[model samples]
Target: MIVDANVRFEALSALLGTKITSLSGGNPWKAAPALSVDDFFIQLILNKKTSYAEEFFIDEKEFFDPGYDFDFTNLSDSAACMRGNEPYVRPKGWYRMALKVRGKYLDGDAWLGTNGWRSYSVPGEWPVSYHGTGLEGARGIIRTHYKAGDGQQFGRGIYSTPKLNEAEKYCKTFKSKFTGKTYKVIMQNRIKPEKRQIIGNYWLIPVLAGTSAEEEKRIAESSIRPYGVLIKEM
Candidate 1:
């Protein structure tokens, strides 16, 4: 679920309070302060499930899916405020499959751009405008580590790549873990892989969570940040 972006090495450092020295900037290439999850918000995500489902498996987005969309659950006019292509604002009806998900969070290819900046031009880099995905992409990834299987590509038993035949494979696995779990997930876009296009394809995201510094580094290594401007830009 880690959405790939040119997060300045400092952007995360500011929040985690890790004293990382800058290789290029020398004076801490990271942003001024550390990042804090206190004020951060969660953009939930769930593809339309053919059957009943409480949650959907979040997988890794490839180089074609745009990974910079925003989440708009707390907004007053979430529907209206999120209408059209504003920074972080998705085009109206972009998430047409949003028939279910209870509106807890915006489902599908959502993202996390602080302050809802969704313009073609990003803060540090990112020249292309992020028209969709929204915040569900970011939260979908974070949730995987704590509750569901492993993040994006590390598919345990629950979530997996588009190669799988059934998307609800985890309903039974975790069902026994949590009794009364009478729900299963279905990739509404299954059978016809083209339906997945309704969510866009481009860019990859690598989510980094947990209290382990070593674990976070491991996540960073295997991440395919085709959109990275910091390293590539360097």
Candidate 2:
């Protein structure tokens, strides 16, 4: 007896208490009744009654429900990090996410004064002040004391001497390391003492390069939505 693929799929969906449209439309199946979709399919296989339809249906338990149990606390922490308005603690879990290659080197160079002296700023174009992106904003704070000809003070300069050839080379290397590279990242939210305040947020500090393709794919699929300075890849 030949059964229509769609008809069989709909029967499976009904048995699992999920919408037939959801199954046919390729959407993630909602939590079904006590009997999971996988269990239902497995029962059919054991009964030896689904042999005719088995050829068209592949057991896709993983696709239907990736078994990773997400920690609600961790998800809350992630949400808090994105908000940037309160102090949050990092929950221990690796989240999969993507980051777009916006530019090379988090820091940028800026001419400090009319005397041709250049200074290093967290974001070269923007003033190195407190930004509201939680931990990232706190990390951008620079600690340095600069003096001019007479009696003056400023932030740290980019180079002590006028020789910028070596500095340019370093910049190129830094750019090469991150630019045009894959955007996939596995990261965790962290908290650290910044000056006087303890700030927390997801950082790119310990970027995880997964050992295998499966691991990488899992990370990419499960990561949190990128926010703040991290742009989502289109």
Best candidate per TM-score, number?
Answer: 1
| Model 1: per-residue Cα lDDT over 1-234, one tens digit each | 122232322222221223222233333213342211111111111121122322222211211123433222233443422211222232222211111122122232222223343334322221112211112332232223213343344321111122112222221111212232221221111111111111122222333333254443333222211121111101
Question: How many clashing pairs per prediction, in order?
Answer: 33, 1
Candidate 2 residue-wise lDDT, 1-234, digit = tens: 122234333433322223333333343323322333323322321121222332233233322322322322233333322112233232223122212212212321121111121232222121111111111112121112223345554332111111112111211111112233221111121111121221121121111332343443233222211111111111
Candidate 2: regions farther than 4 A off: 1-202, 205-210, 226-234
TM-score of each: 0.19, 0.15
Q: Compute the lDDT of residue 222 as modeled in candidate 2.
A: 25
lDDT of all predictions, in order shown? 0.23, 0.23
lDDT of 2 at 87: 31
Candidate 2, 109: how far from true, in Å? 40
